[model samples]
Target chain A: MSELYQQAIKDLAAKGSERLAVPDASSTLDNPLCGDKVTLDVTTADGRIVALGHVTKGCLLCKAAATVAAEQAPGLPVAQAAALADQVRAMLKGGDAPALAGLEPFLAVRPHKSRHDCVLLPFKALAKALASF
Target chain B: MTQSIRSIIPVLARAGFHYLDNAAMAQTPGLVVEAVASHDRTARANIRRGVHEMARRADAAYDAARQSVAAFLSAQADEVVFTGGCTLALNLAAAALAEGLGPGDRVVVSAAEHHSNLLPWLMLAKRKGFAVAVLPVGPDGRLDLADLSMIDGRCKVVAVTHASNVTGAVSDIPRLAEAAHGAGAVLVVDGAQMVPHGPVDPRALGADLYAFAGHKAYGPTGVGVLWGRKEILADLPPVTWGGGMVAALDDDGIEFLEAPHRFEAGTPPVAQAVGLAAALDWMGRLDWAEIRAEEMELTARLLAGLAEIPGVRVVGPTDLAARVPVVSFTVAGCHPHDLSHVLAERGVAVRGGAHCARRLMTALGLDEGCVRASLAPYNDRSDIDALLAGLAEAIQVLG
Candidate 1:
């Protein structure tokens, strides 16, 4: 349990956020398998993300991933923000953790194949939101 | 007795692997496995085709399987139709019944039905211009029959589950049958969950048609049974068509066979049917009264143990009066999938999701669904204890 549910993950997940009042781009995604949902609202400026807000109603992994996305999404280029989701997906498939610092905690989730979607759902919403912008 | 039952299933010999996902698929028994293998090895031929020795053997085995399924439902052999699975059987019923229905005709279904039972009617109703009414589920997860007016004069069909796969709440089929009959509607029951517990007399229960999966009954996959009254089945048109189901093919048109033959299009799952018969034969010899008593005791123990846990809420009826041994629950501040994963790490198997019953989940106010622990005859007290202990740890792990 400690291996997967590390204190860092718990803390990050506890730092939940709400959706933005008015956003440039927003997207909502659902993991139909378990009914986990994540909605992302982004504020973009000068062709880059300046702020990220999220409303995630999912498992601990999903919530923690969404928090990590929210924290690191600021100042990220639109192309790299979408690629970050791909990196996390590849990481879940036994690839190295993305260069992002906060994503390493999700390394423990690498062994759980089914929960991969849970960890990636928020990142997917972020990608979709970026596309919408 | 439990030990002996467990010994017969090869997988139960594995240490520390507690399986509680019997609702999805029961662990196959050695007898059923061997029967399938034996049929494939000895009687491997297309049934109802040539007069060759192998064909005769295969035909005998297939007919015997039909007879066994018929006996289980207390119906005649000619009334049974083998299908790929319970979903296909329900789809066939819907497609065949849709022919007689049109606009202004109402087909009443329950809110507690699995997607397999509900989707077929909804899809067919859209095409046939029939209205589909839902019977509401009570707070306890049982169908609320207080308003039987839903089955009014315009009603043509009443399709529902005999027992809910998630909640394990058994329906009052007799009362439902009475209501359906009073409205001059046919009652089609999804018996996939109930048949696994024990043999059910669909006719006695006031059903015109019944469907159940073979795999859930400890039989081979790719086989299911759909039994309807002889007259009703004769009237129902075939949903599928191919070589074996037809009689003669002229240049102008093709002549189809009778109910069971017309419905069994293409080459059927002969070996799987043989295996289902063997499984049902083994189940027939068992004293269900004793087994059910033990199952109820386990259900009682499971409910009590769940009650002792903090923030754990049972989704279905808390009592064991009219339910099977299936239990579903959710934990506060812990998602069911995460908890199920933690339990899987502890070698406890369970299912977590809407369980293909989205309507029921919405009715129960479960946004993330719940974890279910379904029991079979081979499951004993140790399995229940393992699940309870694993859940305690899962709460801590995901909390």
Candidate 2:
């Protein structure tokens, strides 16, 4: 197994915290190609993510990505989260990985072009959730 | 014979690449490629339209290709219509038959059919206000011919695949034809998968119409064959009308040519047809008994290796006699896409996702789909071994 797959499995096994209470914004995103779905709920205070939770029905890669995003979302400003999502997208699309600690696990997915969507789907959902606010 | 076959495909000589996606598209032989290139270089002209010598040469080559394809399928030249591909051939057949169908008429299709066979009939039924009935398949993915009571008198056409693309299960064409004929319905057989594996005699199989793609049979892409019984071909209306198809263009209406010519409206893929003929000729030269034996051995190895894997579950029949060399399976903790990616990284090529047979995927209860490793005559024991090793590595890593 590649290092990315092992780390992704580890992240997937570690569950995120419970759902956010009365979130200010939420969004649902689905990748129709493989029927992978990710829904994000975020509670923001003073334009910063105070709490975040997500539900995902997808492959291990997607679940792992979502878990990482949800775990790191708290205390980050909404703008930074949105920017991080864009950076993740670029990184998955063969670009050099940015200096983000949580996103280091996804560096192994750079060689798999077809699977970039799995790693980016959760980020997209989070971006959408932030944009709604 | 296997060495000769291997010599024709250069990619097979590569050190590490193991190709197992033959059911989706077979690797073209060197001779087929050379034939098409030669035709393009020497006899490049539109067929059946000009008085120039090049045109005549092109026309003769195209006609000869039609004859070769006819002989390949055990049909007359006039009974074979050159199509864009198998999907178009099936759509044309469905549309031509829809002209005679009415509100009460029904079309019966098997559950194991690819979307190419099922969707066209469903679309035509929606447009013509006819009913579309699905013939159920067994748990093994083989169509159940015993309970074909659904093909009643109201059924106008019975379209089915000669073999299931996913399960590699060969349907009993003769029995299905008998049932359709007893119900007074014409039978259309989708031979896309079957034609590539062996000889197909539509008449002996009792099919009124047969469709197959050239690329899937080690030929060129963009060319397909739709062979219909003479009487049936004559009665079915032309679905395409244009340049070469018209006999006369009057102010009131247009007169079309004979059955096959009338169906091929625009300029056809002449070089592709010739390449297909070359592929057929090459296949004809091989020893079938040897090829079948080798394929059986490779298939047995694949089935046994996959069965031994902890997380892998084969989807089709367990017995070797019940299927061709195509094998589909799912891993316990791995998604098909992820598994396919891992396999590809290890220099193995296979297919993932519903394989254009979403209904069959649903029937098999594979919500996330499965990985398919299909074999061709060029594939051998080494390819199977690579597949097994890659699969084991994938399971150890993912499971």
Top TM-score hit: 1
How good is the docking of model 2, as DockQ?
0.42
Q: Chain B alone, model 2: TM-score?
A: 0.98
Question: Which 10 consecutive positions of candidate 1 chain A have the poorest summed lDDT?
Answer: A1-10
Clashing pairs in 2: none
Worst 10 residues of 2 chain A by lDDT: A8-17
Candidate 2 local Cα displacement, residue B81, angstroms: 1.4
lDDT of 2 by residue, B276-324 (tens): 9999888877777788889889898999999898878898786777567
Colliding pairs, model 1? none
Q: Against the true structure, whose lDDT is highest?
A: 1
**Each candidate's DockQ score against the native complex?**
0.72, 0.42
Off by over 4 Å in 1: none
